[model samples]
Target: DRYFPSSKLCSSCGSIKKDLKLKDRIYKCSCGLNINRDYNASINLSRYELAI
Candidate 1:
């Protein structure tokens, strides 16, 4: 079971959730960050390219 639910933690705002209901498709953080369920999870495993 390789399930991942990192959406509960917002990378942009670093918001961590204690318990995320399965019925919730939307993620709301106290930092005022809003994102879709899938999108939010993707962000956790996502990274961008940058040059030094």
Candidate 2:
């Protein structure tokens, strides 16, 4: 029962980009964090369990 929007969410500031698309390979955050999309998603997914 996991429904988190890990890819669209910023791993640094927790801000979400509603217009993010799958073709984007990089995740850029306004908080000066720019990282690979997969890495960002992985980090965000790891935080999901702790969020509960």
Candidate 1, residues 2-46: lDDT per residue as tens digits? 444476777677767768787888887888877787788776756
Stretches of candidate 2 exceeding 4 Å from the true structure: none
Residue-pair clashes per candidate: 0, 0
Q: Write down the lDDT of every candidate, Cα atoms only.
A: 0.69, 0.89
Lowest lDDT 10-mer window, candidate 2?
Answer: 1-10
Q: After superposition, how far is residue 39 of candidate 1 from its true place, in Å?
A: 0.3
Give the lDDT of residue 11 in candidate 2.
93
Model 1 lDDT on a 0 to 1 scale? 0.69
lDDT of 2 at 52: 77
Instruction: Name model 1 segments beyond 4 Å from true.
Output: 1-5, 48-52
Candidate 2, lDDT over the whole model: 0.89
Please name the candidate that would achieve the greatest TM-score relative to the true structure.
Answer: 2
